[model samples]
Target chain A: MNAPTSIKEFFESGYRQFLPHVSIDCAIFGFHDNQLKVLLLKMKNVEGWCLPGGFIQWAEPANEAAQRILQERTGISQVFLQQYYTFGEPERNKEPNLKDLIDSLNIEPAEDNWLFRRTISIGYYALVEFSKVTPTVDLLSDECCWWDMHELPKLLFDHDLMIGQALQTLRMQLNFHPVGYNLLPEKFTMPELQKLYETILDRPLDRRNFQKKMLSLRILERMDERKSVGPHKSPYYYRFDKNKYDQALQAGILLGF
Target chain B: MNAPTSIKEFFESGYRQFLPHVSIDCAIFGFHDNQLKVLLLKMKNVEGWCLPGGFIQWAEPANEAAQRILQERTGISQVFLQQYYTFGEPERNKEPNLKDLIDSLNIEPAEDNWLFRRTISIGYYALVEFSKVTPTVDLLSDECCWWDMHELPKLLFDHDLMIGQALQTLRMQLNFHPVGYNLLPEKFTMPELQKLYETILDRPLDRRNFQKKMLSLRILERMDERKSVGPHKSPYYYRFDKNKYDQALQAGILLGF
Candidate 1:
C-alpha cells in the first residue's frame, strides 16, 4: 500500500481511534554481520524515514501499545524492551518537512485531526538478532527494513533525537547489563561478541583485556564447539549461562568502558 | 495553607489551566545527618502524603514543567535534574483513596475537571543538600518536609511507585556520576561522604576500600586542615575539585557497587 491509500484509510477509519496527543516509538536495534542496525519505516511517497511507531489506544497502556507496534511491524516477541525517555518538546511538531510529509500523502487533514496537535512520544528500545525478524510494512509506511546506524536517513519529527538518546541509554546499560548475548547467534565466537560490544559502545577495546574482564564476570560459558573461518585459527563458541548472567546483572556487572 | 483553602482556590481559580492528561513528579532527594531523605508533602485533612508534583502547561516542555515544579515547592534552583522514567499505566488513576483525597478538601470537582482524568507523569529526580532548600507547602498540601527513605508515609496515587523507580535510577546513576558532592556540605570528612553513599545504596562498604576508590577518581582535594572531635584523631576535610569532577564525569568514573 502507498501513501494515498494509507492517508485515506486514516481519515476514514483510524484517525479518531487513536489516543489524542500521545504516541509510542520503538528504536529496535538489530545486529548482524558485525554491524549495528535500527529498524526504520520508509514513508511511502515522501522521501523520508522514521522509526516504527504507532499511536497509543485510549484503553491500552503505553507499554502494551509499544509492544503491539513492535509486534505488528517486525514480528519479534518476548524480548525485553526498555522505556528510555519521553520526547515531549512542544516544538517537535513544527518540523520543517512535516508539511511535505502531509502533502506527499495527498490528503488535507481536518483542523480537528489529532495529527496536527503536539505529541508526547514515549521511546522504547531493544537489542535483537537481525535474523529473528521478518519486517513488514504497516498502513503508515510502504517499506520497512533494517538500516545501518551510521547511514540513517533524516527521520520525521524528533525521531533523530529519539535514536540518539536510545544509543546513549544502550551504552550506559551495556556497562551494567550483559546485553550482547541476545543480539548474537546462539553459539558465537568471542570475536563476534566483542565486535558487537565495540559497535554499541563506539570505541575500540583491548582484545586480551576484554576477554579477561568478560570471563571474570562468570556469565559466558565456553562451548566445546569451534568455528573455523577461512584460513584463520578456529575459535570456540561461547554462550551466556542464563542464571549466572541474571545473578551478575543483579550484582552490578561493571564493564570497563 | 491547608487542604480546605488549597482546594477552594484550586476549584475557584486553578482548575482549568492544567494541560490535560500529563503531569510531572519530582522525587527530590536530600542528604543530611548521614541519611538519605526525600521531600514529601503531607496532604492536609487527609492521611496520605506524596512527592512534590505539578501538571504541565499545554505549551510547555516536560523538562520545564519538572523544573518549575521543583523550584515552586523547594525554593531551590540551578541544580542538576535528570528525567528517569515516564509512568503511563491506565489503572494508576484508579486508586481507591482518590475520592477520599478529593473529599478531604471539601470541594466538589466539576464533571469536566482535569483532576478526574488519567494522567501520564514524567519522573525527574535530583540530589540536593538538605540545608539549601526551604521547603514550602503548595496549594494542594498543608505541610512540606523531608521524610527519611527508610520510613515513608503512605503516598497518594502512583507516587509511591514513582519514588521507588526514582531511587532505583539514582542507585544506577551513582555508579558512574560523582553525585555525592552536591548532596554534601563543602569540606566534609571522608566518612560523611561514605555514609551518604551507603544510605543511598542501602548497603555497607569497606571503609578503606571506599576511600581508596573515591580518592583515585581524583575529584576530591585533600586539605591540610582537619577537624577534631573531643579526644579522637582529627579527620582531614576534603572538598570537591569542580574542574576535576567535571573531567572525571566526562571520562565516565565507574564506582564499584
Candidate 2:
C-alpha cells in the first residue's frame, strides 16, 4: 500500500505479492533411436502433463529464467536455451479464474485480486540429448517422463501450442544447420543421425542423398570405424569436429537436414 | 468488482479487466545508401520521433497486436515484424511514474488508477522499405520520420536496447537471406544493396563477390538498364521481381558468396 519512491523501490514494489507474475517454461526436446522425445512433468492436482516451467525471478535476467529452471529440474546446466516465442493469449488457462492457481500454489483463491490472478507467460525451447539426461521427480510434480513426441497426451493450458512452436523451430533449425550432433550422443552412426533428423522433419530422406549432403558439410570427423551394435555390420560412426562444426555453423549450416 | 460462479459468468463477472501492459515498439528497418534507416513515428507528445508501438489487447493474438500497431503507424500493411527481445528492466522509463503518461494521453492527472501506470514493454523489429512507406502517425503519437541508424537520439525507455537487438537481427537476416528487395526501393543499383548490408552489419563486403552472389540468387530482375539518379551514372537500377523473389525464397536459395 506504499508508493514506490525510487528505481529499486519501483522494481521491488509489491513484487513478492504478485501471482508470481511472469513465468518461463522450457520445451526440452532430444532425439534417440529415431524418435523425438519431450520432457513432461505430470502435476499432482490434474491428470495432465506440463512443460518444466518456473516463475521468472526479479533478480535474475528475464531471458535466463528458463535455463535456471532447466538446471533446477534436470541437472543439465551447460546447454544453451534459445527463446523463440512468447505465448500471451488471454484465455490460455482452463480455470474459470485464478482459483486453480490459488489451490495449487496455496494462495487464497480470490477473484478480486489483480496480482496473482493474471499473468503472461513466455515460452523457451531447448534441444538436448535424451540419453545423457537424468529425469527428476521433483516434489512439485507427481512424475517426470520423456514421452515420445508422436505419443503425447493431453497437455495442460497452452503447453500444446508451445510444443508446436518448438517443433516448428526445430524443423527450421534442421533445414538451416546440422543439429543432430547436439540432439544425439557423441560418436553416433550415420543411421542414428539420419533417424534423428527424419523424426524432426517427419519425412523420409533418401539414405544415399542424405549421407552425401551431410558429409559434404565437411565438418564430420570420422571416428575409428564402427563396432557391431545390431544385426548388420554397423555403419561408420562419426563425431562432428567441434572446430569445424563451429565454422560451418558460422557459414550457415542450419540444423535441419 | 464481482465474483463469478460459472465459466460464462467468469468472463462476464466484470473481473476480466484488461491488464495494464506495455506496447511493443518496433522500428521496421529498410536499407538505402550507405546509411541504414528505419521506419519510425512522430508521437503527439514528442511529435514525429518515435517507433510504431501498441498495447497488447485483452482479446488479441500477440502477433496480430504487433501487426495492428504497425498498420496504424505506417500506411503500409503486412510488413514482417519479428520479436527480437523484451525490455523489462524497471529503470528503462524516464517518465515520472503515471504523471508523464497522464499529461500526454490527455487524461485527468488525478486518474492514478489509469492502466498506463504498470507497463512492461517488449520490443519487436521489422524489415520495411523507406520509399514505399507513407508514415502515418498513430493517434496517440504525433509526427513520423525516418532517422539514420547511426544518428539515433536518446530514445525513451529501453528503446536503445531494442535498437541494438534490431541491428543484431538485421545482421543475422542478411547472412541468412538475400534481403535487399524488401528493404530497398524499386529500381536500385547493386551498389545500393551492397551498401545497405554493409551499413546494417557495420562491416565491409567485397564488392565483386557481393554482386556475384546477389545476381546468382535471381531474385532481382534486371530492368532496362540502370537509370542515372545523381552524380555517376547509377549502375543500372534494378527492381525486385516479386514472383521470382518469392519462388527463390520458397525453393530456399543459398545466401552466400
Candidate 3:
C-alpha cells in the first residue's frame, strides 16, 4: 500500500467525509454579436438548466477548482474568473433527482443525507469572447451553449439568484474597473462595447453621452480602421491599451454603470 | 428526538460537528477622529492579535454567521457587514492547540486534522463609526481594540491579507459611493470629511479643489453652523441629504478617480 503523503491524500485524511458536498458554480460571461451572453449547461440526466459547475475536490483551493472547471468544460486557460458570491441557502439542492444520484453513489446513507441537506456553493464569474472557444462537457452535463442573457431558459436551484448576483457584481465591478477588454474581443467597435454595458445594467444608455464619457476616461486606444459592419457609418474599432487601462484603473475609472 | 427541518432546524442538526471547525472572520472598519481604524481581537490562548472571528453553525448563511459573529464578538448589530474575500490556503490553521480543541469536541479525528489542514475561511468587512463602538471579548478572545491602520501588531492566519483586501475594497468603494457620512456623525465639517478620505487614501488632496469637487456632487446639505474643533479657522458643517444622495446615486455622478 502507498503512503497518503501528497496534497490529495493529505486533505482526504481530514476532509474525506465532506467529499463532493461543496461545489463551484460559474457564470461564464461572454460578449459577442453586440449582445451579452452566459455559458450554460443542461443537466446530464434531467430536463433542467444550470450554470457551469463542478464538485470541489478535498485538496483544491476554491479558485483553482473553478479555473480547473473552466479548462475541463471549455478549452481555455487563464481567463478572468472572479469569485463573485457564495450561495448558502439551506436546502438549496434537496431535489428528488439529486437525492437519487447521491444514493446511486453508495455514499454512507446518513452522511449523504446530512451533506445533501445544506449544500453551500461558492459562485464565480468568468469573462471570455464567444467566438474564440469550443465547449467540452464534463461527465456531469450533456450540452453547453452561450445563451443570450435576455433569452435564457428556466434554470435549476438558485442559479437564477447566481445569475442576478453576477449581473449586480458586474455593474459594481464596472464602477471601478473597465471590463470590455477582458470581457470582449480585441477589435470590437464602440457600439459593441456600449451594448455590453447596457445589457448588464439592464437599461438604455444615451449613445452620444456614453461615447463621450467613456472616451474621456482615456482607457481605450482607437485603432486605425473601422469595423466593416454595414451601410451606417461603421464606427472605429478600439482595443484597450494596457498602459492607459492600468492608469484608469488606478484612477478608479471602471464605472460605465 | 426532534425533527431537524427549516433553516433553524437545519442548523441544529449539524451545528455541533460544524461549529468549531468553520470560522467566519470580519474586517471591522471604522473611520473616526480623522484616522482609519480596524477592529482586532487578542487571541484567547496566544499573545498575538487577530481579526474578529467565530465558528459558523451548519445552518447559517455565511453572511448571517458574519452578522452573528460581529454582534457576539463586538456587540454591534445590523451594521454594514459585507462579504469581501475568502481565504482557503490548505495550511491556514495549522496550530496544534487548535487541532486539539477540534478533536476534544468529539468530531472525527480526521475533521480536526482536516480543519488544521484545510481550514477555509470567508472574510467579511463591516463599516462603522469607531467613536461609537466599544469592543468586548467573546469566548474565543481575551481582549479587543480598535487598532490604527498605520501601527498594527502581529496577527494570526491570513488576517493581514484580509485587511489589505478590505482597505483596497474601501478605497475603491469610495470612488463610487460617498462613505464618510456613515463613517462619521450626522453632521461633519468639510475638512473632517477631507481628512478622513486623506487618511484612508494616504494622499494629501488640495483643499480648494477638494471642496469645490465635493460641493459639486450636491450630496451635502450645507448647514449654517461651523464647528470650532481647532484653534484655526473653523469650517462650515454639512449633513448628507438622503434625497440628494439617492439622486446622485441614480445619476451616477462622475466622482473623479
Best by lDDT: 1
Per residue, candidate 3 scores C-alpha lDDT tens digits across B101-135 of 33344444434343343556777888887766779
Error of 2 at B239 (Å): 4.7
> Which digits, one per residue and each the tens of the lDDT, describe model 2 over residues B9-87?
3223322433454446786886656577877664445522556776665666667778877876666777767776666
**Most accurate candidate by DockQ:** 1
Q: What is the C-alpha lDDT profile of model 3 across A122-204, one tens digit per residue?
A: 88998786776687765446788888998998888889899988987877777667777666777878888888888777788
Which candidate should be chosen as best, given TM-score against the real structure? 1
TM-score of each: 0.91, 0.71, 0.82
* Candidate 2 local distance difference test against the native: 0.68
| Residue pairs in clash, model 3 | A177-A254
| Pick by TM-score: 2 or 3, better one | 3
lDDT of 1 by residue, B77-103 (tens): 888788999888987766743566678
Please report, as a residue range, the 10-residue window in candidate 2 chain B with the lowest summed lDDT: B6-15
**DockQ comparisons of all candidates to the true complex:** 0.63, 0.23, 0.31
Candidates arranged by DockQ, highest first: 1, 3, 2
Task: Compute the lDDT for candidate 1.
Answer: 0.82
Per-candidate TM-score, chain A: 0.88, 0.81, 0.79
TM-score of 3: 0.82
| lDDT (Cα atoms) of all candidates against the true structure | 0.82, 0.68, 0.72
